[model samples]
Target: MEHRGFTALGGDCELFRIDLGGGTLAEGEAWVRQMHDRFTRFSESSELSQFNASAGDWVEVSAEMDALLRESLRAFDVSDGLVHAATLPALLAAGYTRDFSLGSTPTAMPPPPPRPLPELLSVRDGKARLAAGAAIDLGGIAKGWMADRLAERLGDNCLVNLCGDLFARGSGETGEGWPVGFGDRSVLLKDMAAATSGVTKRMWGPGLHHLIDPRTSRPAQTDLHEVSVLAATATDAEIYAKVALLKGSADAAKWLEGRAMGWSFV
Candidate 1:
């Protein structure tokens, strides 16, 4: 097995492949860096930043951007508005204006009320547009999307783990599956994906964190600190994990009854 590790998207990233050479690992690393440079919300010159700045006007987007925009819309529908991409303004108002690694100071201002994603964003004819006051931070959805893409590009048998959003493809060296760390134990995952979502990692104060509840447009006040989920794809896993966390312990289990292959909450 060949392995490569690097830091990107505000956290550690790693890629592993079976029956592949070092050059493939290097190429994967480069692609991850390129995606980070293009979509990172912390950089003003990034494509995502430029789109956020041009709210209310139609802006031409690359094919990659178009696909991601469409995925964001799909995420909204699948998660039932729980996994919103256009929660950047609410996140900023909650004092998550910078990358979590650098730390943040809480603000006293309240976030604006939530709005439906369909009402706030539209994509068509190689172009995309945001409503007058709407802005988006792709965040975990971008990571999950990138992981899935990287796995396909890496090889038939590979695992791409960008931060905690990961996709496992093909069989392992022994032909069982890729050994992945779940909540407290290692699980063999084959042709599946997993993602973890939480408020504990990024919290700055009593009520300040990055996981904004689209229902209230505030940092979610949930019983569980974190939740991990398994699904058919990294994108679906990401959406499931976030929705599970936001639903809190009381309702999370019932809501996730048949949605995930496996799940753990803490």
Candidate 2:
């Protein structure tokens, strides 16, 4: 068994492998840093930043960018437009302009109303475009997507954890499953993914957090503080958890029924 831990994408990251046969933990860490540099909106030189800057014009994109863009569109459809990626403006308006770990002082300002993602973004022929005023922050989607990618690259038996979003591939040393800490107990997961979404961790002020409700274009006001979900992929888990949290306690269970393999709410 081997383990590596570090920080990237504004959160703690970890990689684990059993009887390594594929990529090394060092290489996996490097790959994560590379992806963070490419996708992060904080860096002015990042591809995502460049894309955001090039709004209103079609810009060439790499294969990874194209895939993620398409995944963002799918998330929009899966969550019934609740898990929007084009909420950068709204996030900024909510005073999350910088990484939450670095602390930001948010001013009292209302964000612009949400716009339909499909209408503002389009992709074709290895190129993509966003409307003039439209910008996107991949956020949790990118983390989950990267985790799944890293898991594939790491080995047949490995786990990739980026913050609370993670992917577990293959069985663990015990051959049962990879033991993971959930709510109050440990659950063994094999060839599956888990993600937790919450407002408590990122809150900076009253009613200020990273989770933006696309319906109102503001921080969500929900009865539930957090939600964790299991799915076939980390990306799917992330989308499900966010949607459940946004749906609040009363309606979350019904919406999450049959959508997730397992779920817990707080």
Candidate 3:
């Protein structure tokens, strides 16, 4: 069985149970909504918006916010800065100031020089802060992270797909693993997760997307059409898949093995 609903992260939240018959779909929607309320960029009063507003100031945030911040930071490090979360400035400059479905509003301002997120992020106890002129957009990872987190609330035979990013727990009805169709082939997932990232989904202007190249503060010009990765968790899949897609081909392969993410594809 499958259930779908609009997500706070600008995509649909899809909950599926292999065997069906679980009365958790509504609860899963609620969980997804709760995460959206806290993390959505569309809401000015959301926790993430508050945190973004407090840039350059050490601000108090919810425990959930702090936890996700650290996770984004970890993604930043593991991807060698290719998958940086602090690309808000770049995104805004590219006319992605609002949701992609809303159509682009051109902005000519160039983004400020890119900086490593670790240099700007400071998280201690339950408080977090960013350096002056720094901002972070968790849209890069929150969907997958929230999917992984919500999977714990689901049954053993469940799959969570936040937009195209996916996570699988127990085996589906097939009894072997969850069948995920990608391109010309498919993969079985058991006690694992997968995610796909590409520049095609949310493009604006000539070639603008949430995936920004730190070296130029512009959308990365990767040659891969898309990347799919099955990993230990949704967040890891999101991070590594994106990194692989951004790197492209031989370099992406070497990067994945170097990072011990041999399951990633592009």
Give lDDT: candidate 1, residue 254.
89
Number of the predicted model whose lDDT against the real structure is largest:
2
Which is better, 1 or 2, measured by lDDT?
Answer: 2
Off by over 4 Å in 3: 1-8, 18-23, 258-266
Model 1: which ten-residue window has the lowest total lDDT? 105-114
User: What is the C-alpha lDDT profile of model 2 across 23-107, one tens digit per residue?
Assistant: 9999999998998999998889999999999999999999989989998999999999999999888888888877677787656
Q: What is the C-alpha RMSD of each candidate to the true structure, in Å?
A: 1.4, 1.1, 2.3
Question: Which stretch of 10 consecutive residues in model 3 shows the poorest summed lDDT?
Answer: 257-266
What tens digits encode model 3's per-residue C-alpha lDDT throughout 1-266? 56556564677667887545454877888878888888987779999988888889999988889889999889988888887878888888878787678887776676765788889898999999998888788885888888887777777788888887778889887789888876458888888888888878777656666677776787788888688776788888889888887787768777777443335354
- TM-scores for the candidates: 0.96, 0.97, 0.91
Kindly list the per-residue Cα lDDT of model 1 for residues 81-181, writing each as its tens digit.
99999888888888888888777856756666658999999999899999987889998999999999989898888999999999999997779999998
Whole-structure CA lDDT of model 3: 0.79
lDDT of 1: 0.90
RMSD value for candidate 2: 1.1
Against the correct fold, how does model 2 do in TM-score?
0.97
Which sections of candidate 1 miss by over 4 Å? 21-23
Q: In model 1, what is the error at residue 85, expressed in angstroms?
A: 0.9
